[model samples]
Target: MNSSAIAAGPVFSARDITRVYRMGEVSVHALRGVTMDLYRGEFVVLLGPSGSGKSTLLNILGGLDVPTTGSVHFLDQNLTQSTDRELTQFRRDHVGFVFQFYNLIPSLTARENVALVTEIANNPMDPAEALALVGLEARVDHFPAQMSGGEQQRVAIARAVAKRPDVLLCDEPTGALDAKTGIVVLEVIERINRELGTTTAVITHNAMIAEMADRVISLSDGRVSEIRRNERKRPASEIVW
Candidate 1:
């Protein structure tokens, strides 16, 4: 953890958390006694392979899923004990999620796509402001089909951040783009984390991306294998596949 982050305390504290999925007669453990903390304004990367439970843990932290055992605290609120409605409210009020694929509506322009989130948020950035923040001011009127994959992904990012959520949870945010374009998307995310001071956690299989994080947490076979803090974090522009 960063020293500053430690002094501020954690925005999220998860303890002995585990998730078990039952498929017919068999049980699959997605998380095994995962304990972690995400501090305000710090960038952390969850590094893992497929089925390593990074995504599951991210979802749990974002209130998309609850663990079968243990507890998760987002500030003073216990997410594990929240009802479905409370979890929904929790996600709406505090979390911003960016997935691998851009989930923009095809018919909506970039500004309109971002407006969908701002409309429901308690407090939000103007859609145009959010688009500008992601370097998409010129593309605000462009529809999904008019944009490249990277551009569309930026629009997705714009939408997620429009609500000015407390935390930005990204899952393989650049997995679908080429190295050059992926670097661009990462630059946007990095800028947001720095400028907005939104607690950010990104999940990736690419080890090179970990260099940009304040901490790198390695996960394997549903368990956290290692956690290391970066003494000198690199900028996203210097990262490559």
Candidate 2:
């Protein structure tokens, strides 16, 4: 964690949160007494195995889900108390999400795919500029099917960031790519965090990727097992699978 970001206080404060899914006779606890804070302009990695609740926590933070118990406050707003419509607006205005899949439109070109978000966003970047930020300047006219996996993922990243969101949440962003391509994606994420100062949280099962984060948050069985801050963060370019 950057000391400066810590000084700025938390952008997100989640307290004593619990999420339960009821399915007929069974109840699944996706998050159990989870409490965490995401600071402004910091890069955090959510490290965990499957069923560890990292994705659940990310979803809650992104306003896609609400906790069954406890509170989530984003700056002055109480997310847990927000209505579905309010949450929808919050997501629209503030949050950006990238997942394992590219989630790009098949018929749309790279610039067109990113333009979708920019069109709905307030004070968004030009789609071409956003694509250039992800090193896809020359490929803006290419369709998702025409680009490589890494390039497609970069388009997804560009779309997510074009709105100039305060926070970026990515779940297994590099899961679909090979090591070389994954590193390229990681580099793009790192650049965004450094340049745009977006508070970023990425979910990954790969421990090696944790080295690039300012802080690594480990989850186990629906709880935060540990939180470790790196004294000196490693560059994504130096990381290997």
Candidate 3:
């Protein structure tokens, strides 16, 4: 890995971001002055225990949520200053997200699920190509009900990336699967980041997954505790549970 390449300004930069949730009389602080940068074409793993604010930060980066303070700049665009409509367009245009659960429609086949996003994208890949990228070409005609948990999740991943978004934000992507199955899903994600050069960020509690990331960011109590760069990144298949 080239230090100069990593030092080049990040594709996504967050500065002193904070998120507070008000619950009736009490206010819950999810993120306290969190600052970070995600460089272009790098796979980053966000490691944290529950309530560590990893997901909140991911959501804010994906434009699904906003911070209470500070600013987020995706490339040169200031996301914090964008209106709701602009944020919506930003998400559709530049971001792709995958969650722990495979939120595929039961009635839709894998191809149709991916087509849902390609239909609206500006310069989208073909639905079949997207499914192929995730190694799901053979399962394109299968409905979500007919597929295994990992397969359905792959379909979800395909749908997310069909639009060829610059960034892929995954929140606990492998959280619901068994170890072996999770590795399979992780491999697909790794392949996408490698082959498509998508700037990927995955949130996970599993420390083993950090081995596959170019950089591992650990969060504690709504703050970034540490960030470590991997000298030799390991393949996801080599990650032991």
Candidate 4:
């Protein structure tokens, strides 16, 4: 990739964002003041310990939550100023999110779970095609209860990407899986980013996962502590830990 392309303005820009929770007499500052950019088609790893505000920031970026102060822009649109209905539309049309839990409906088969999204999306891939992207084509007929943790997670991923959103935001996507399974999950994510060119951000507590990111952003006490570029990005299969 050219340096100029990498330096091009970000797809998502956040400035002076803050989030605070008031617990009666106590005030919890989840994000002090976070400013960052997520470049187009780049895979970013958000590396932080628990309570570091990585997930909070991801939620803000994805329009699931808003900051107490400052502004966030996705492309030319200001998310901070968008109405609830507008935000909902924005999320439905532009963003895809995968959480730590599979959240697949127990009664639905893998293909049906993915079809639930594709059916609503404006321009969606076939449910089976989405499953194939995640290496789950053979398991499309299996229900959530019949699949392993990793397989279920892949189904969740398939559901998220079936709509072909511009960005993919994943919060602790591999948190519930074993080492081998987590790597397999990560490989799927990595493949999606590479092949589809979907800008992706992954929140992870394990620093070893940084090797696969185009850039690594580290958070400390709700603030960005460091941002580094990985000159030689490794495939997720080679990441240990």
Best model number under lDDT: 2
Q: Residues 1-241, candidate 2: write the lDDT tens digits.
A: 5678788889999999999999999999999989899999899999999999999999999999999999999999999999999999999998999999999999999999999999999999999999999999999999999999999999999999999999999999999999999999999999999999999999999999999998999999999999999888999999998
- Candidate 3: the clashing residue pairs are none
Model 4 lDDT tens row, 1-241: 3466458888899999999988999989999999999888999999999999999999999999999999999999999999999899999999999999989999999999999999899999999999999999899999999999999999999998999999999999999999899999999999999999899999999999988999999999999999999999999999888
Which pairs clash in the backbone of model 4?
A: none
lDDT score at residue 218, model 1, on the 0-100 scale: 94
Assess candidate 4 and give its lDDT: 0.94
Query: Which digits, one per residue and each the tens of the lDDT, describe model 3 over residues 66-146?
Result: 999999999899999999999999999999999999899888899999998999999999999999998988999999999
| Lowest lDDT 10-residue stretch of candidate 1 | 1-10
Worst 10 residues of 4 by lDDT: 1-10
State the lDDT of candidate 1 residue by residue for 213-235, as single tens digits.
99998999889899999999999
TM-score of 1: 0.98
